[model samples]
Target: MSDQLDIDYTRRNKKPRSLGDSERAKLEEFIEAIHYSARYSDNDFEYRHVQLPKQMLKVIPKEYFDGARGTLKLLWEEEWRALGITQSLGWEHYEVHEPEPHILLFKRPINYQPPTH
Candidate 1:
């Protein structure tokens, strides 16, 4: 169950950088499809195959998908779940925000240090 094959997505400033136009588009499409499926379908736990393209994967870093060992099927499932929760709620007037432009950005806490001479 090692996620040793996943990628890193963090930057030095501890902020996730914005995903490029193409990657963002693909990710949004992927998330939207899955979210809608989970929200509208009777089978919420159905297994689905969402293929993220190589170009989109290349823009993202290496750490985001490399953690958490468990029942999740894909490296990005956790993220998809987080984003799709609202859809599952069945809110009548709710406005589901599009996935963030930087969906692949990773934020890991780190101690800040100043350079010394």
Candidate 2:
């Protein structure tokens, strides 16, 4: 879908808005894209890493990306947890002298699973 979410980032009272139908569908589409890439790997021993650029990052609600740490996790934890995926923002170097650019890392089978303790 090529629709933009009508999110008001400058609101008061700090009320959180659930993603619109199109937005949620887009999120699931992105997940499916990542899932398909990880589909053939061994579930127990292998993980897939998908690097998304700023363009693709638009799929996510801006609040999550712009908020404090743990905010993003809190927003999408359910879906991501079910898919064994975890995300973080980091830099990637593309050239010897070029400045590194911020990127999102989506990794499968999260590095550390839930601790039984």
Candidate 3:
């Protein structure tokens, strides 16, 4: 598949900017959910829908629906690497029994390694 990362995230020498508070909160929630799936499942991959809290939901409101929000936050490969994720796949790639039609299925082997900073 073609790389979907923004050109900005593609710059190796560029100093990645910090995510805003709201975005950070969302990512943290996502991290928890993703980690749960990864640790519990025996499969080589795991997936989770972004379930922002009601309070945080108000902040992002109509910007995105469930898994779509997760996809946006994880669109960049750099972000993927930071999360110890090997391959990230979306609805366009495959479907699962998720509540939302959209879902993010990620591939990380049982003996996976994260990228060194």
Error of 3 at 60 (Å): 3.3
TM-score to true structure, per model: 0.26, 0.33, 0.31
Query: For candidate 2, what is the TM-score?
Result: 0.33
Model 2, 8-117: lDDT tens digits are: 32321144445666777666545544422242234422333334333445666666443433223322334333332344321111111112112322223323344356
* Model 3, residue pairs in steric clash: none
Model 3's lDDT to the true fold? 0.35
Off by over 4 Å in 1: 1-45, 67-78, 81-117
Better of 1 and 2 by TM-score: 2
Which pairs of residues clash in candidate 1, taking residues 3 or more apart in a chain or in different chains?
A: 7-62, 7-63, 8-61, 8-62, 8-63
- Count of clashing pairs, candidate 1: 5
- Per-model RMSD to reference: 15.1, 12.8, 8.7
lDDT of model 1, residue 26: 48
Sliding window of 10 residues with minimal summed lDDT for model 3: 4-13
Report residue 41 deviation for candidate 3 (angstroms). Answer: 3.1
Error of 2 at 36 (Å): 11
Query: Whole-model lDDT, candidate 1?
Result: 0.29
Once fitted onto the true fold, the runs of candidate 3 whose alpha carbons sit more than 4 angstroms away are 1-18, 21-38, 46-50, 61-107
Worst 10 residues of 1 by lDDT: 89-98
